[model samples]
Target: MGRWRPPAEKKSKYITATGYKRMNDELKYLWKVKRPEVTQAVKEAAAQGDRSENAEYIYGKKQLREIDRRVRYLSKRLDDITVVDRIPDDQGTVFFGAWVTIADEEDNEQRYRIVGPDEIEASGQLISVDSPLARQLLKKQVGDEVYLQKPDGSEIWYEVIAIEYEPY
Candidate 1:
């Protein structure tokens, strides 16, 4: 099979203000602090001569390439994203940046905050707006039922218990 793959589908451009700031801070740190430190190390390694066998020099160059790639991606993404700083007028309804509490039929309760794709963290509390669950939760209010179809073909239902804009 050919190595070529189709391009990924574009993600939503909406981002919470905190998420945007976090990305901006990362870009600045990589460009100003991390990049300079790595560059200095590479320069020192090169001065030692015989770069072909120099592990430090080769590693530093690879690090620089990775940093540059990340910087480029962050710069372009920041320019394209829209920061959502204001709370929606309808606080009772689910929307971007809203923390929603949901309960299953068995009375198991779970909470999640709907955020932009860039802000989806390893923490399970945050869900991307592009996610199937978030899509179903959008515009839903308390006492509303949401149905989500899992990849395994099992469907589950959840009831909206609460929705809040402020972070706990």
Candidate 2:
């Protein structure tokens, strides 16, 4: 198997206190409650029959393995991760946690919020701050043009329309 981890990326300094608590709570639940439950399930399934042909036993083992895998991942990840709670000083540009609106050359408008990797949601266009598009947008202000390299041998350009971090 390939190596399980890469060098940790710097996290954004933009998550709210509530967001931090949510992450911590999830980690605690996985370690204390879910891990033990899955372990007990695996033990019970293993006791039921021969290991070679038992479907329940096989699936139970897989479940245990996945749980253990996540537990190890969370332990390592949480240690290296620094929760980003302080909002950025610059509010006029597209900074971490800022909701930005952009208009393409074709006049199609899009909205995105630059967020930390762990908290990003594709559905909301909540992109990670480390993403190429976000990187290109870092310090640009209204009406400034930003271009992003795409995998399809072409680039896309967007004109910054607005940036905001206040109450929506």
Best by TM-score: 1
- Model 1 residue runs over 4 Å out of place are 1-3
Q: What lDDT is reached at residue 30 by model 1?
A: 100
Give the poorly placed runs of model 2, Cα more than 4 Å off.
1-19, 166-168
Residue 98 shift from truth in candidate 1, angstroms: 0.4
For lDDT, the strongest prediction is: 1
Superposed Cα RMSD, model 2: 3.3
lDDT accuracy of residue 101 in candidate 1? 97
Model 1 residue 114 lDDT score: 95
lDDT of each prediction vs. the true structure? 0.96, 0.78
**TM-scores for candidates 1 onward, in order:** 0.96, 0.80
What's the lDDT of the predicted structure labeled candidate 1?
Answer: 0.96
Write one digit per residue (lDDT tens) for candidate 2, span 46-97. Answer: 7887888888778877877887787787677666666655566777877666
Compose the digit string of candidate 1's lDDT tens values, residues 1-168. Answer: 889989998999999999999999999999999999999999999999999999999999999999999999999999999999998888999999999999999999999999999999888999999999999999999999999888899999999999999742
Q: What value does the lDDT take at residue 48 in candidate 2?
A: 80
